[model samples]
Target chain A: MALLTAVELTIWVLEGQIPPPIPVPGVKLGLASVVTLAAMAVLGRREAGCILLLRVILGCLFAGSFSAIIFSLAGGVLSWAVMASLIGLFPEKLLWVVSVFGAIGHNAGQLLAAVAVTKTPGLFWYGPALLTSAIVTGAFTGLGAMYLVRALRKYRERRGF
Target chain B: MKRKTVFWLALFAVLAALGAGTYLLRGVAGRRAVVSVDGEPMRTVDLTAAAVPYEFTVETDYGRNTVRVSQGRIAVVDADCPNRDCVKQGTISDGAIPIVCLPHHLVIQIED
Candidate 1:
């Protein structure tokens, strides 16, 4: 569990090092979410949840500014809620697939928060622009996680480290 | 996979088309006195008559955009930032759309 928490932190920092966020409305590589998958795979759900929660909070503190916290927090919290509920039903391999929905949920949550904060419905016009991009980015991140899981399984097998 | 790809592609096309059409086809109405952010009715000044000077600041994350409004027209006469999206945004006659600087949290939308 301690090792996984450290891993989560490492991944969060790595994700942050990916400087200059995409110029698009809502898109991220989400390297930390790959660590999230690993945590859930190796540790049980409870431990994984703790790691994720801490990762998000600390990640926000370290990587993001004040305004960014709102968007990431909404996305992380909503994504975790929905994923936690569905985890029981789906196979472990499906974690990344669920993460896609989580990313979209995060975007939707951020947009809703922005509209509420700004009192502008016209801003929602960005929705279609965001969602289409989300699918592509989500799929890319999901595929990356799939490969990471596959590679991690192989390394853990050989090194037993 | 082929069918799913086709379905998603179609959905994207439709959404893009709708967004573009709505943006371009939006109608403009005649100018009148409208309430602005400061809760004052900004009356339309006669363009052919003498010009009046007005100035306002647009707060942005990177910096601020200072705008000048005169007789039936507005422009970003001075700005601190280089991108100049605020300057190019021209006059915000429509309340529905405002001069938005995404880099900055500033918006100048019209209101009733």
Candidate 2:
């Protein structure tokens, strides 16, 4: 759990340093979700949630932004819930689909937070763009997590854990 | 294909289509630009009526952004915010997307 949390934090911070590929606000690759997804597949939903919660809290502290915590928590929790509910229903081969759903949930949650924070209904104008970016980024991170999960399974088997 | 795969694929196609539909349909041709800060109306300008291009600055606790306006369009040309995502967004002639400076809690939406 500790190691996974660290990995997630590192990726989250590293990704933050990179400018978004496009000029859209709130659109990100969310590469840290790769670790969360792998944990969900390998370590179970509860463990994954723990890692996600820790990573989000500590990440916000390290980043030194109080407002960021609300957005991160909102996005992270919704994404985790979506993935947890769908993981067992979908075969391992379809983890990308699960990831895509989680991404949509994440974006929706953040949109709600943005709306509430700004008290602006007009911000909903960005919804379509956010959803489109979520699908693209989610597919990329989902494939990454799938490979990570497979590698970890082999490693665990070799170590007889 | 398996039922699950087929179902997901169909769902993805529908969602993609919906997103595209929303994108193409959300643009408003109105020449008015409404600028708001933290939900409060900051400024409103009719882009079509502006005889000369002008710029204005919005200062807030979050940050500052300079918005530029001209005939038929609006944009954030400069901002002190770190990301500068708003500046890079260039301009919006329609309501399809607002010029959002998240750090500044600022939004410039063009509407009729």
Candidate 3:
């Protein structure tokens, strides 16, 4: 079930188009991060990491795009690492910050890959640009998780997690 | 008020200041130029000061391409190229980036 959820998240972002702004490069609905955030809050880092790796590998195979895999893997690993670090440092209530930082981390990882692929350090100038995008998208996704958790907790207590 | 919240928030603020600053600076300088394919240098124009929108077409051994530039931006409004990636690149306003038609090898760069 978790596996299915993660796969669906990846597919939605790739095809989904949000209006006007088009997209800021790699940024998206960040649905995967939603799963990441939920795993951290409900499951644990190890379980979250398992989901993360599975999704990255499966998403890569399904998409059949090695380049996309490289981009997403780097971002996913880095974001997961950031989430783990922040969760350790902060109280449970502060998961939103995890989303923001993870988003930035995701961009940094992707930017690093971009720099490697382009063989251009000038691309590093895009780092901050990508980070700002992470924040907006991250905040939105983070808030999404926040509300989702509130609802899930009620359901879980009734049905048991 | 958690320690991690403080830590992450501070870091994102720095990133935002730097990123938005660069993006806004990019907006201010305003750039427009032209690129060519078939190893030919056609012409370069400063789009910021142009009095009106310009229509341009490139003729290559491959085929012909028609582009439109308006408001200091460029897009391949029409092209005979197999893949219309150039037309789909949309209006490129970023100074550092250029609208490129890979099939036709036409480039529109924004310049100082």
By DockQ, who's the top model here?
2
Q: Ranking under lDDT, best-scoring first?
A: 2, 3, 1
Sort the candidates on DockQ, descending order.
2, 3, 1
In model 2, which residue pairs have backbone atoms overlapping below 3 Å?
A: B30-B112
lDDT at B51, model 2: 75
Which candidate comes out best when scored by lDDT?
A: 2
The Cα local distance difference test for each model comes to 0.56, 0.85, 0.68
Question: Relative to the unseen true structure, what is the C-alpha lDDT of residue B104 in candidate 3, on a scale of 0 to 100?
Answer: 52
* DockQ (CA atoms), all models: 0.12, 0.43, 0.24
Model 2 TM-score, 2 decimals: 0.85
Per-residue lDDT tens digits for candidate 1, residues B13-90, read: 565566445544442422432322222222333322326666766553456667666654445555654344456556
Cα lDDT tens digits, model 3, B1-112, are: 6676677678777877888787666654456565556335566666776568888777777568787777766667788754454665666666644454544545555656
On residues A1-161, what C-alpha lDDT tens digit does candidate 3 reach at each position? Answer: 48535654665546433432544433465776787777677767888788787877776676454556676788899998998888787565676777888988888887776556434444565566676778877877888778766776787799885
Candidate 2's C-alpha runs over 4 A off are A22-25, B28-30, B49-53, B60-63, B70-73, B77-90
Looking at model 3, the pairs that clash are B32-B111
TM-score between candidate 2 chain A and the true chain A: 0.96
Q: Report the C-alpha displacement of residue A104, candidate 1, in angstroms.
A: 1.0
Residue clash pairs of candidate 1: B61-B104
lDDT of 1 by residue, A1-161 (tens): 56666777887677545543664313456666666655555555676678777876776577545555665677667666666666566555555555556556666776776565455566676565555555555556666666766777787899885
* Higher-DockQ candidate of 1 and 3: 3
Question: Which of the two, 1 or 2, has more TM-score?
Answer: 2
